[model samples]
Target: MKSSRGILCSAVLLIALLAPQCFAEDWLYTVRKGDTIWGLSHKYLKDPLKFQEIQKYNNVKLDRQLPPGVTLKFPMEYLKFAPAEVSVSAINGEAYFVRRGVRATLNKAHKLVLGDILVTNKNSSVALLFADGSELLLGESSELIFDVQTKWGETGMVDSRVRLMQGSAEGRVEHLRGPGANFEVQTPSAVATVRGTEFRVRLDKEDDGIVFNEVNEGTVSVQLHENKESVKEGYGLITSAKLPLAKPKELLAEPKLVNPRSKYLGHPVTLTWQPIDEAKSYQVELFKDKALTTLVHKAQVSSHQVSLPEVNLGEYSLRLRAIDKDGLQGLNTIHHFTISPVPRSPQLKAFDEQYIAGQPLEFSWEESVSATQYRWQLAKDRQFRNIVTQQELKNNTHQLPEGLPAGTYYWRVAAGNIHGFGQYSTLKRFDVKRPKPPELSLSDKTITTEDTLTVDWQAVPLAEQYLWQVSSDETFSNIVSEGKSQTSHLVLEELPESELYIRVAAHGPYNQGRFSETKSVVVEPEGNGKTAFGIGSILLFILIL
Candidate 1:
C-alpha cells in the first residue's frame, strides 16, 4: 500500500511538471557561459530556489550540466510578459530597435514589443503595422516608442499609445467598434488621442519641446498638460511644453486653377488661382506628368497669380496650394496643361515681280494662325549674306522703309510666338528695274558764227519725255541752258561765245534715268569786211610766191 501511494504521487508530480500554466507569463532565454539556472532564477524571479522549478519544467536531469547555447523556458507567476504586438513592415536605410535594454538592427518582418523604441537615421524611414490594423510611419531622424496598453488576445476595450520623442510621424488608425477603444499619440509638448483618424504628429527637433498635430480625416483631441483642444479635419493645433494649448486654426483651402484651360504646349503659361481669405501665401509647382512625381519648377508668391517662364514643347501638370500664417499647408489643387507644337511658316501673298527704284515697295503675306508676330527679311544674296532690310511686323503687310537699290533680291518670312520661332518661308525672287538713259548726238560740234545748234537723242523704252541740259563746267553746277523735250530733239537758237558741254536724260513716271555721254561745242565771234579783205590778200600773195 505504501509503494502504490508513492507511485501515484510521482505520477501527479510528473503531470504537473509537464503541463504549462495558462495564465503565467513566459520568456525564452538562451543559456550562455557562466550563467547558471540558480543565478538566472534569482535575477529574473528574485528567488534562487525557483531554479528547481525551471529544471523540473524543462525536464532537465540533475546529473547533466546546462549547455552554453541551449534554450530554456521560464514561466513567471507574478510578472506578466508577452510577444511583440506590432511588426516592422518596411524599413529604409538604417534603423534600430531597442527592447529590454538590448538594441538590434531593425529589418523587415522584425517584431516590435511594448516599450520598444525605434530610431531612424538621417534620410531613413520606417513603417510599422500593429495587430489592431493601425499603421505608423516615421520620417528621417525620428524616434518612436511603442507603449501599447492592450494585447492581441484582450477582449475588452484598451488603449493603443505611441510616443514620439523626436522628428515626425504619420498615423492611420483603424476604426474601433467598442466604446472604450482608444488610440493616442504623445509628443514632448502635446498628446493627441483619437477614436480613429488619420493624422500627423511632429516634435520639433530645433525647438526642443514644441509639438504640432494635424488631422487629415477625423477629429483629434490634443492635450498639453491640463489644457485640451479639439482639432478637426483640415485643421491643426500647436503648443509648447510649458504653454497652454492654442486654439485650432483652419487650414488653407485648395486653390482654384483659372488659366491654361486645357491648351497645348509651347506658349508662356499664366498660372492664376482664386485667392483664399486666410492664406498668407501661395506655392506653385510644375511637374512633367499627371502623377506629379517629377518636379519641373517651384515658386512661392504672395499673390494669387504667376507667369511661368518659357517651357519646352511637351505635356505638363501644374499644382497650387496655400500656406497659412503659421506655415500650415492646405490641400493641393491640380491642373493639367500642354504646350502646343511650333507654329507653321507663313504663306507669302502674291506680289509684283518687278518694282521701280525710288518707289514704295509693299510686302504682304498670308496670315499664320498660330503666329503672334511675323519676321521678314530681304537680302541681296540668295544665302542672305548681305541683308538689305529686316523687320518684325505685327500685321501681315509691311511697307519697305525705302525702295531698294536696282538689283535682284531674295526675300523670306517666318512666323513666331511666345514659345519659339518657326521655320522660314520659301525663298522668293524679285528685281528692281532701273530706268534707261538716252544716247545724245549733237548736229554741230563747233559753232563759228552760227546762231543755232540742234541736239538729238535715242528714245528710251519706258521714257515718257526727254530732258536736255548745257553746262560750261563738266559738273553741270552752272547750267548755261536747260529744256524739256517731247520728242528726241531739241534746238538752241541763241549760242554763247564760249565752250559748251551738253547732255540728255530720259524721265519716267516714277524715276529719272541716268545722264547720257556729254557732247562739246565751241562758239566764235563773226568778222567784218576789212578783216575779210586782209585775210584774202595774205592768201593770194602766198600763192603767187
Candidate 2:
C-alpha cells in the first residue's frame, strides 16, 4: 500500500510539471480541402505520433481528411521553431538588457534573444531592427520584455512579441510579407497586434488601468480583457484593463508648427504651434539627428508652446504631436531645424574704438562662419533705446549714414543667419568728439621791410603745439611753407616776394583741431639793396582783416 501511494504521488507531480506544455498557447490551423492531422504532422511537425494528442485535445476524430472550414488548435510548444533574428540598430545614452538575471549592455555587437528585458535610462533611447524590416524605438525611462521571438521552420512566418512594462515604445512595422507573420506589443492592461504599419504603445504612468495606443499608417487590434477593438490608421484609443474597449476615435490633428523653418538661431529655443481644437496639451521631442534615434530632450506641455533648454550649436530635429483630453498622443510630425547657433558675440574690431559722428563713417567687426548677415546699431543712449543709426548687412562692416551730428554715442553688432539672430555684442560706448578750433590773434603785427616780423596768438588749452602754414592761395590748398611752434608766437624772417596767406591750427596727440582764420602777410623792400625778407632781418608785414 505504501509503494502504490508513492507511485501515485510521483505521477501527480509529473502531470503538474507537464501541464503548461500540454496546454500552452494555441496555434490555430485552418483545415484545407485535403488536410488531415496525420499529414500535417508528417509535413511540419517533428514526429507524426503527436497527431493523437492533437486529435484528443481538439475533439476531432483521427482521419485522413477533415472538413475544409474546421479550424483546429495545437499547442505552440509542439511546433518546431527557430529564433527570430533581432539586431540593435542604434543606442543613444545608455540602454541595457537582462537575460537569465545577467545584465548586458546593449550595443550593435551584442546578441539579443528571447526573454531579454530591455531597459532604457532617462534621456536615453534604443532602436531595434527585426528580420522582417520592422523597427522599434524603446523610449527613455521605458522597460520592455521579450516574451516571444520565433520564426517557424521554413513556414515564411515570423512572430515578434514584447511586453511593455513601463513608459512607451514606437514601431514602424513593415507590411507582412506572408500570412501568419505577427508583431505584437503587450502591456499589463492591453495587448496590441499589427500585421504592418506604424504604431505606438505606452503604459499609462498615472493610471494603471489605462493603456494608450495609436496607429499611424495601419490597423492595430488591441485586446483588453475580453473585448477587442480595431484601431484603424489615423486613430487612437485609451483602454481600461477590466472594461471592454470602446471604439477607436480619430486622433487629435497634428498642430501646425508656428513659423516652421529649417533653422534655429539662439538659446532657450521656443517651439510653438497653432492650437488644435480638441487638444489639451502638446508633446515635443528634440533629437540630435534626423534618424530620431538620439533623443536629447522631451517634454509634455500644457500650452501651445514649448521651450527647449540650451544646447550646443548644430543641426537637430524636432517631433511634435498633440495630446487629447484622454492623454492619447496623436500622430507625430517631424520637423528638421538646424540649431545654427547665433555666432558668438563677434570679436569687435572697430576703427579707433571711438564714435566719430560724421558722414561716411565706417564700423567694422570680426566675422563668423555661421553668420549670413550682421546687425549693427549706433545708439545715443548706452542702453540703445535711442538708435541713431542701424543696418542689416551681409558683410561685417557698416557705413554710418550722413545725418549724424557730433555727440556722444554708443554702438554694437550682432551676428545672424537664416536661423535667427544671436545675442548682441557687448555694450560698446564710443565717444565722438569734435574738438573746437583755437582763437588766433596778431599781438605784434607792426613790421618794416628790413625788420623781422613776429606773429602772436593766444595759447590753446588742449593743444600741445601750434601749426602755422604759409600759402599763396587763400584756401591754402597749395601750401608753400609750414612749421610747428611750442610758444604762442612765430618769427618769420624769410618771406616770398609775392603776398602770402598764413593760418594756424592747434595740434594735440589725438587730432589736430580746426584751423583758425587765415591772415595776409606782405613784405616790402624799403631800399633796393635790402631783400624783401631774410632770416637775418627783413621788413615783413602780416595783414589781418
Candidate 3:
C-alpha cells in the first residue's frame, strides 16, 4: 500500500513539474474537505515540516482542527503551474472575449488562452501579443480565435495561428528560427501564410464571403481551395468561397499635383493631378490644417481635375486619392497650400489740380494691407485711349519722369501681391498749365517828339488778356508804364525821347506766361534857333502864294 501511494505521489509531483509556474510571485489556494496543513504542505511543497511555517504565516492554531472553505497563501517556492496564455497589448473602444464559454470584457494586460475568442464591437479594436513578439490587431466588428502552440521548456519559436471569422485583421509576424514553426491567419474564404511579414486580411459578409489580403512589408501567400498566389509588398489579392483565388495586383501609387504646386490664394482654384492606372475616379479634399483634421472642401470627380469654390482666407491642405473600379481607395497624397484674399483697391492720394510743365508729378496712393507692390497708369483721355505712362512700383509713391507734355491727364493705381493685382482705383484728373508768351512788335522803331506810340503782339491761345510794359532799364526793373489790354495792341499816349524798352506778356486764367523780346526806340531834340527862323520865312512865303 505504501509503495502504491509513493508512486501516486511521484506521478502527481511529476505532473506539477511539467506545468508552468508564476514567476517570482506568491500563489493563493482554497482549502477543501479533508485538507490538513501538513498534508497540504507535503502535497504542494513535498515537505511536511513546512506546515508550521504556513500556520505561522496564516496565523492559524496548529492544535486546532482545520476548517474547509478557508483560504491559504503559499509563496512562490511552494507553488507551481502558471499557465501560458496570450496577452492583450492594446484595446480601443469596447472589446470582449469568450474563454471556455465564459464571457468577459477585454482590457490591456488581460491573458487569453488557446480556445479564447476575441470579439470587437462597432468602432472597437484590440491588439494581441504573443510570447514570441508577434502581434495581431483585430479591427472593428471583428472576431478572431487565438491558437498558439509553444514548445515545452523553450523560450521562443511559437506556432501562431489565428482564425478570422469576420471583419478585418492586421498582423506583424515575428521571425521564428526553429523547426516546425509557422505563422498563418485563416479566414472564411482564404488562408494567409506569412513569415516575418506585415499583412492585413479582411472578410466581408456583404461581399459573399470574400477575403481580401494585402501585404505591406514582406511576402504573403494567399491560399483558397486548390489555388494560391504569393503577394509581395505593395500588392493585394482577393478571393471568394464560391470562386477561385484571383491573382495578385499592384496597388495604386500616390497621385502627383499638376497645378498650384506651391501656395495658392485665389477664388475658383482649379486643382489638377496625374492620373493613375486603372483609376475610375478621384477624391479631392481640402483641409485647414496639415494634419487634415479640419475639412474645408471635399469632392469626387471622374476626371483628374476639380475646381474649388471660394473659401475663408488662411492656410490649407489638399489631399488626393484614386478610387478603383471596385471602390477601393488608394493611398493619399497630401500637399499644403495657402488661401488669401485679393488685396484691396488702392486709394489715390492726388487731386484735380494744376501743375507746371517740366515738373515731376509725384503720384501717391493709400497703402494696402499685405500688398507687395503697386501698378499705376497715366492716360490722356478719360477712357485711357492715350496711355502716356504705365509702371509697376514697389512703393506706395512714384515720381513721374521729367518732361511730360502739358495737358489734361487721367491717372489710376492698383495694389498687387504674390497672387495677382486687385481692382484699380477711381480715375483722377490733373492738368499741366504752361501758357506761351505773346510775340511783341512796334510800328516804328524811332519816335521823335511823337504824340502817340503803339505796341502790338501776336494773339495767344486761351489768353484772356495781354500785358504791356515800357521800362527805362533793360531788366525792366524801372517800369515807366504798365497796362493790361483786352486786345493784342496797346497805345501809349506819351513817350520819353531817350532810348526806351518795351515788352509784352500773355495772361491766362491759370498761369502768367513769360515776357517777349524787348524793342528799343530813340528820340532827337529839334534843331537850333537858325533852323526855326528859316522855317518861319518859308511859312510866310507859302501863305502869300
Tens digit per residue, CA lDDT, model 1, 1-545: 99999999999987554332344444566788777777677666535577787888887775147888887776545222233367777766788989898999998868776678999987677777766777787877899887764542232233477888998887788876343356888888878988678787777668849877777778999988888888999888777887777898777778887654776433445777788998999978776677453455667899989877666667888878787887676766788877667666678888888876655788888988778888899999999999988988898888865576678998988888887666677788999977667777888877755568888888875567788888988889989988888898888877777888999888865457578988888877655256788999999999999
C-alpha RMSD for every candidate? 19.4, 12.6, 18.9
Candidate 2 per-residue lDDT, tens place, 257-344, comes to 8888676656546777888888888898888888776778888888888878877889889989998888888878788887665775
lDDT string, candidate 3, 1-545, tens digits: 99999999999987655433333534456778787778777666635578888888888885247677887876645432233567777676788999889999988868887678999888677777776788787777889986654432232545567799988887778875443346878888888888888777878658737877777678998888878899898787878888877788776677887855464534446788888878999868776667443445557899988877677777889878776776554556788876556676688885647875655568888998889988899999998889998999899998865635678899988788987876677799888867567777777777655456778888876667888888888988999889889999888866766778989887764447578888887654444256789999999999999
For every model shown, what is its TM-score relative to the native structure? 0.41, 0.56, 0.39
Residue pairs with colliding backbones in model 2 are 448-539, 449-539, 450-538, 450-539, 451-538, 451-539
| Model 3 alpha-carbon miss at residue 388, Å | 26
Query: Model 1: residues >4 Å from true position, as ranges?
Result: 1-84, 89-94, 100-105, 152-158, 257-321, 331-545
The global C-alpha lDDT for each of the candidates, from Candidate 1 onward, is 0.75, 0.77, 0.74
* Candidate 3 regions with alpha-carbon error over 4 angstroms: 1-84, 149-155, 255-277, 280-323, 327-545
Candidate that beats the other on lDDT, 1 or 3, i.e. the better one: 1
lDDT measured at residue 41 in model 2 versus the true structure, 0 to 100: 75
